[model samples]
Target: MSAIARSTEPRLDSVTCASPAGLHRMAYWEWGDPDNDRVLLCVHGLTRTGRDFDLLAQALQGDYRVVCPDVVGRGRSDWLIDPAGYVVPQYVADMVALIARLAPARLDWVGTSMGGLIGLGLAGAALVSPALRPSRGRWGLDATPDVPLGRMVFNDIGPALDLDGLSRIGSYVGQDIRFASFQQAVDYVHAVSQGFGPHDDAGWAALTEHVFHEQDGQWVKHYDLRIAQPFALQTPDATTAAEALLWRAWDHLPMPALVLRGAQSDILSAETAQQMVSRNANARCVEFLGVGHAPTLRSEDQIEAVRRFLLTA
Candidate 1:
């Protein structure tokens, strides 16, 4: 892919939203025309920030208003008062408030990992009638008119996640680590994020720049360590229950969906991707070879796949 022009900087914005524990401000990076009605919401993966989508957003901004949010407890967003509030339900609630703020006539979603689960929840909620919605009050979403997801790009996630991948991720997700210098931080990021596939020095450096912040003359990861509480506390029964709910949500998504998986991904396996397409006629699947866990949408091939899916009539 071509390098993102230095002039195509995103505007930073935030909105106040209610979580089960309390209220917090969710920060988002907006690209292109704010007045543009075609809003595309791009959410990041676990421990990642909205800046993760910088390349993708820059590529598509001319065609749509791209909104990338730093999900609560990560990036510039506020950390939750309670660690338990880091689950999907709370994330979904915050997103509902964000959608309300955007008030777009048309909306599309691009979600990576945890973000995909949120998209599934939003799309599922839009499809289910209020009467049939579970007691969580439509996944804690307010009674707003249906704002269906026009289309979605689910990057390296699905209802059935590989336990091995989950374990590998949990092993390091919330660890508190510090670096004495920017180079040290970048090196650390590269060590932990090898699953993001092969990227040259420049690509890896770009990724590291967004994930680490300088604090007290030292560099540290951007997210709160407590963001891993939910993962740490999950029981096998809870996992089974969550998986069932996710499948139900996946089944309810009526919009056309694109499932992008890393060929070597331990999370969303090839079998799971096939199952997703089989269950939902509108779903299509694509795989990127030589990648694992996730494909950073920064590459030319990856961006092209997403652009064609989202821009197609």
Candidate 2:
């Protein structure tokens, strides 16, 4: 229901993979049974880490093995030597490596913001002609027969994004910010993340806890600042091209999908959510009132929606 009790902590782990530049390690946090065949992979938004799903993972750990990975440049993952490699293609490659390691019979995905784009790529590629699918050997894994997505949840993201919203996000994503104290860091998180809707003191604290680390005696956000470079270089034409590709991906998805949109969201507009469902008969959308860019699945209501959707047969 509400946030998970603080007593239950996730198991932290990492996996080695390669990028265009060289090899790097991607860290992940796991909850639930390691041997469980059902796997749920939760990926965080830009500038956020995998630990963001702590509460959601806690709620579903009993029935499924919930794994959340910090996308390459964020959290415990090693930053790439070439910042230019910080694109969705690289993120997707790393995730494929992760899936190979887990080797689940069935896989489901929950992706937020940039993470959602990766899910779209995986699900779309799995459904399309084999030639379009990302090469398994590219990531150093043998071609395991297509691991069908059991279900997918795209949190406040869709094929089409609002450029204004993206610009606003870009303003803060990779800033060189430092905090004098933990409380100060929490305050900064709250300020930038007000769109996540309201949270009690403890809930807010829990959300902020894993996002910062002590560096040179100062508290700094955990992600590599270079992660923002590619984002900063986006051109209007590039965005248009990407949107066309995403729409193609959305139309080709074969598995059931749930789209959660914040009622006040600027990132994932209501118009795009409507288009998503219209294009794919298996897709459905739910809007959370009073929330903005995204819904942090920390509340009882938010958690229940995801739990029911994920557990459905």
For lDDT, the strongest prediction is 1
Location of the lowest summed lDDT over 10 successive residues in candidate 2: 132-141
Candidate 2 lDDT at 260 equals: 93
Write the residue-wise lDDT of candidate 2 on 1-313 in tens digits: 2222232788889999898789999999998888777889999999888998988998888877899999998889999999999898788878878987786777888998888999997766655445333232221233434545678999999999899999999999888999989889989888998889988888778888888998888999898999889999999999999889899989978788999999999999989999999999999988899899789887888889889998888
Local distance difference test, each candidate: 0.86, 0.85
How well does candidate 1 score on lDDT at residue 30? 91
lDDT of 1 by residue, 191-251 (tens): 8788899999898889989889999999999999998888999888999998898999888
Q: If scored against the real structure, what TM-score would every candidate get?
A: 0.93, 0.93
**Residue 208, model 1, lDDT:** 89
Clashing pairs in 2: none
